[model samples]
Target: MFVGHGLGAFALVAFLATVAGCSRERAIQLGIVAGLFAFVPDVDIVYAPIGLLARSVQTVSPDVFWGTANTVHRGATHSIVIGAILAAAVAAWNIPARVSRIAAVGGFLSIIAIGAVVDGLVNAGVLVVYVATGLAIGEWARRKRSSTGWLFGAALIGLVSHPFGDLFTGGPADFLYPFDIVLVTSRIALHPDPTVHLLAVFLLELGTIWLAIVAYTRLQRISIRRLLRPRAVAGSGYAAAVFVIPTPTIHTAPLFVFSILALAIVGVGIPAHPFARHRRSETLVTGLAAVTVGAIAYAAAYGTLG
Candidate 1:
């Protein structure tokens, strides 16, 4: 899901940019900027280490560690209001240097101030890191000389779309933070059965990654379908895992995830020739296709048996 966030943003923005008449190189650059910004909200995960270090016992289970660390995971950073402000600040970088500095500083401080008022100083400290990350990405876009409108659009789309993706996996994000409004109260259920729901989400994530891959190939003027190999079909064998592993839910999915992902080994059977120009790319495309096939096969088996 973490990688899905960045890649999803990249795919959407890059495709839109291409359709909007941007040069291929310019579209790719804008997409990269948006993809980076899409990762800013999750920076709250950084709190995991700090929490672990402060504990009397050094070790904790995965659930305990994540629970402790994610206290502020979907807070102010996910807010559309906050995202808009950051986008504006980033876009301002195209203006005079002094005004740009003022906008960036002012936007950063304003977010911290809101966080302090709403969630307390500790969470506000987290906001500081988050704001810095957004600004750093904005600065990078500025250096790339991205147009003001394009920069703002990329930032806004990337930051804002992130929260929606979360709704499908866990608790809803605070879409309107510091305002005491709850837009969504629960995770969006894709299926009635827990195992099926988890599988659905997993397939959705794989689809997103594939979309990003297609977008990349388009930018490089390559045909993704042609790069894939017959070995990918071997992934269908993963359906056998349905009979062996315990049923998986969103909360307990490591076994299912790991087992299905192991099918990626099928992609390694590439040309051994040293002079094969597209060998690396072919292997990667083949691997992704394998994983995609495996997940679908597993889902179909689970649906039939369970």
Candidate 2:
């Protein structure tokens, strides 16, 4: 559910941002901090979307919500400039003069209770961590300049890191919109070319998943080499199985073994771990990688919505 056409690869972006944020000292904590706000830019999805009834209604496409972003999903909101603006707002606003750990804990639980929104159910703990980090940072950035700078720094890291996730699927985000113009695009086409799109998505997910696996393995104190062997067996087996399933296709789906084998072979190179050596800061490097595989497989097997 947290996965999308790089649209909601917030986990991957959060993973990288956390690594650069606080080192291993606050890896898990800051990772959760960044993860919570990483997808806020997409909150613009509610512009014309049904409020609480969205899930029940199941409107196939959220037309206006995305259209507000200049007729695209990654419009004005996706801009690094907009991200900075948001960061400024957070910095300038008098959020809470002082927050106690007790208050933060209460707020964290409240946020989880309110997790009826998209992407909320899966990652509500992010909200909890975000507040916890904010409290910690607020104490550290006590000086006016330091406070503003740290606020700006963390927000910028969370906001700007996301559009690169969009690079895997849609047209590239316009990093510098009104001030200067630069539109990003992926060499791997998103849709029209279904096979190529799936291929690109598989690679993108593979990279992110590998990072998470390495980080998680280290965090759990599990040996990376031992971890990969089982995961490799599973992942490689899944890749191989993809071809054998009687999945639908435009052609004779039953006789599509060769095509499936080729697809699986492409995947065989995808490793259980992408790194030859996991870094010393392994705890900070990851979160939520395997979830995307299910979403990707469903889209590939089911084909386009139309």
Supply the global lDDT for candidate 2: 0.45
lDDT tens digits, residue span 124-237, model 1: 888889888887898788888888899989999999989999987888998998788899999999998899899899989999998998998989899987888998999998
lDDT (CA) for every model shown?
A: 0.86, 0.45
TM-score of each: 0.94, 0.48
Once fitted onto the true fold, the runs of candidate 2 whose alpha carbons sit more than 4 angstroms away are: 1-25, 51-72, 92-151, 179-182, 185-194, 216-222, 225-306
Q: Model 2 over residues 17-98: C-alpha lDDT tens digits?
A: 4566644434444344345446555554443333324444544443433433333245545667655555544554424544
Which TM-score value belongs to model 2? 0.48
Off by over 4 Å in 1: 270-277
Question: Positional deviation of 51 in candidate 1, in angstroms?
Answer: 1.3
